[model samples]
Target: MDQIKLTMKELKAFIILWSTQSISTLGSSMTNFALIILSYQRYESALVTAMLSVCTYVPYVIMSIFAGAISDRWNKKYIMLASDSFAAFCTVFVWILLRNDRLEIWHLYALNALNGLMNTIQQPAADVTTSLLIPEKHYQKASGMRSFSNSLVNIVTPMIASTLLALTNIQTVILLDLITFVIAFLALLFFIKIPEIQKEKTTQETVLQSAKNGLKYMKQNRGILDLILFLAAINFTASMYNAALPAMILSKETGGEVALGVINMVTGISMLVGSIMVSLSPTPMSRVKVILNTLLLSMSTENFFLAFGNTLPIWCVGAVLGWIGIPIMNANMDVLFRSYIPLPMQGRIYSARNTLQFFTIPIGYFLGGVLVDRVFEPFMAIQPAQGVFVMFFGTGKGSGAAFLFFVLGVLGVVTCLVFRKDKNIRQLEQ
Candidate 1:
């Protein structure tokens, strides 16, 4: 059998999309990274950062169904281009407000909510569009390119945000974010031409009936549901880490931005390396396997990594391992799902998936806040070492909270692993 590869033509089309997506993501990440730093610097509380984290996911929980419906009815390419432009304008306006030193935490919340709404529209559209642009044989390479672009954006922009925050202030970072999105918008508008993906006919079905049909299909295909649930658990678990990682590093006591930046850079580098490895060693293993293995290592290592803070080498090694493993699990799943689901209803299915799958992230954030600020702090008062405020690793009594997340992943992985014998798991790479 001849191996399928992406032609230069298709590669170019995908890259145009990928590059634009990367630029937009880079900008959003900068704001995201900056917002946490800003909140921590000013508020000096982990609670605020956790709120910001929760706000980021709240929109995903809210508009996921509507986002899916729009993608199903509309042209995704135009949606991508328009949403980027709209989001850029929102960023620009937010940047301007911040520039005058009128920045309020509420401003961050409101703008992020708007940004999340845009993302609710944009991300699913882009997710489905990958299959529209590239041939099946080329998925691994195409996926690598996307992963490469994501890692590279982090490599470039995250540190830039870090450096800018240190050297100047929030205003400049906001401006750069505004500019990057504009550049991304231009690339999508002028360079890419994605043909519309038509939805399958379900002429007689009611709305609930259509949703039921998709749900029934997924129910019968237990492996896909298993796959989705496993990742959902992992994502909910990881949300705690993501919500707190930067704060944990800064901590005024453990280390600071430099430490956070180092960890971030390591994570980005790990993702970069993982993308390359996946393309080289594409496999038929259930993506659940890949997710479980990486996240298991990540969750387990995270439980104990702070204990080794004196050993910079060990912490660095752990960071890279977690970073690489998690993204591989993620990238592979996208490929697998696309292969299994038909192109037409991908929007609606993914919409429902997004809505259901991410329902817990905000809960994770809110729970993290309550644990860190409310529970952990009180526990420390009761017993000093039991609730020790170790500023070095940013673990409060909330350390237990973090551990709980890791356990969630571990338990979820165990439940999903039993499905290895399921036929759907065996057929993804075909």
Candidate 2:
């Protein structure tokens, strides 16, 4: 039988946890934004900024499977607290380094790697805890709430970080993140109680064996595996698009840091609206339809915007239409995961799935940087007014990145259309 329906007690607990986490997330977002801006200003290279993603995701990719096993065997609540505590310490370390004027690119990279490990450890535990707390029926609504929090952070962080940077320094931003972490850790430690999942006897299975079993399960379930592979591929393109976007905004003669912040705020507001829409609506019977259709709409609109939009206002219109699909699609995907996967296996399965799905993100980051810095930049740089490349992507600093966005957008749409025809994916929830 499914877990109990959503109750007042559960809702209240979830709210407390959600609120605390959201605050921490907002703080982290601000720090990350500041770091990106700092990195760009220091190096003036897209590759350096993109390499930050590599350092962050490499550890996450390596630890995901192991972290899942650990979460399943251990107490999730404690694991979450420990992870947050470690992350808070890392933030403090960064703050100290900055204060000492000893912070460097390599230091940031190493810290990002450590932070990724902490996040990897926390992700499965935190995710399954949410699933355990909320009933099956409310899964979509809960996901919407999560998305809402994320969008709210994205909407506010850029402007906040910019203001803080202008007034004080990056260390001040890091200090705020440290404070949020403490608040979140205390809330989880004191008030939230996560229920344990019932596990079958596996007396002989070791942690490594358990991870293998998770992989074996995926191999047997072709539908789930196929879905994971599809997402991984599409995510590669999406990552490239994401990594290149700020460059597109900031590289142009007319575009600047302010323009980038404003664009992000607009995108965040659109995502917030989408999450609200999903929360108000009933869960669809066919989640597959929701996922695929949203993917198609987002990819098409985003690419269109990047390829043709010459001004910030034009980009803003595209961002609104393109970003609106993300929360709806993500909420439905979460509902599917909860409905199909057994609770006991979720920690392991989700971790393994995450590794597979995000394995190519680093590659995407590298590829995005290279495409913009080497091939597209040179190609666009030499173009005349009537040249084909300039005609398609305009002629300027960000035009190369814009061209890359167009290409990725086309690829994303094609990937979604192909995945739509996959019998296994269509019947995955069944």
Candidate 3:
């Protein structure tokens, strides 16, 4: 009876945390969608838009090495609260700048960098808190719920932002973010209590040493290391696709912001479907196979169709097929991580995993933008080459990006196949 009561209490806490955080994510997504529109309109360069992601990711990758260790040492709840407060302040600053007509692209870049840094702090702490709240058996379900909220935010934010932009301005979108932040903040402050983790004090070990220990642990656990490395490769290809998609869609004569929004809505719907399936389904026994198989499915469908198809309907079809596997793969990955890593070491190890897995993303974003703007786009504009490339990727403004997507698709598919052969990666199934 007592165990049942305790389980219900923890589940209730998790639900509250999830709901409030989802509300916050919805607001943040709206602001992000609005900014993407504003930035693309103002700069009219793929590199400029991609640089926003680069700035955010660079700081996140750099800070995560230490952030995880700090989270292990500090109180998780306080770390999350502080990080959220800082992020909210950054959002408010953006709103003030917009209201005063003083906002520049550089300001957004700088603020995003700060926000990314804060995320490094909040993410590991939040991960640890979730582990504390939920039983191990429910990790997959919790992850699915997280993915569902994220996908729903992705779907709703664009439509909302597009409507608000049509009706009002960026300021209104940002103000909405502020309102949501307060709701999330109060909910975490008053409604939820994260259980305390007991840690042995090592007075002699420095923070840097703790971070090093995390790396050492990963090296010793070859399966985890291999998995993270594989994810790094996957993230690289995915980042390039992400950076190119906006340029491709917006550059199309027929497809504008509304078309892009519709495509995003389609993608989000697919992901929501995937999350629902993951939440309800029994946890798979062979998580490694699920991860690899889903990657193959996602890479093949999304990039292939996006590369060849020019029409919005074709893009929507590709989007649906490509995105559906993501939540399924991610939920399994979370279950594997939570089940394998010790709860005490999870904060540090998870951060280390993140650092390794996401290091390639900024590089991918930068290279994707540069290659599209300088190399592929210009090359496709030439005569004989344009004629040849147009046969495969249709001629026009986005043809260059389309060609890049084709190359990335091929690479992603090949990478997944090669990684699937690794015995060490497969050993994680045991």
Top of the candidates by lDDT: 3
State TM-scores per candidate: 0.87, 0.96, 0.97
Collision count for each candidate, in order: 1, 0, 0
Give the residue spans of candidate 2 off by over 4 A: 1-7
Per-residue lDDT of candidate 3, residues 184-254 (tens digit):
99999999989977766632367788688889989998998999999999999999998898999999886
lDDT measured at residue 18 in model 2 versus the true structure, 0 to 100: 95
- Among the numbered candidates, top TM-score falls to 3
Give candidate 1 misplaced runs (Cα > 4 Å). 1-6, 203-210, 285-288, 307-312, 385-430
Q: Mark the regions of model 3 whose C-alpha exceeds 4 Å error after superposition.
A: 1-9, 202-204, 384-386
lDDT of the candidates, in the order given? 0.69, 0.86, 0.89
| lDDT, residue 213, candidate 3 | 82
In Å, residue 83's CA in model 3 sits off its true spot by: 0.9
TM-score of 3: 0.97
Positional deviation of 280 in candidate 2, in angstroms? 1.1
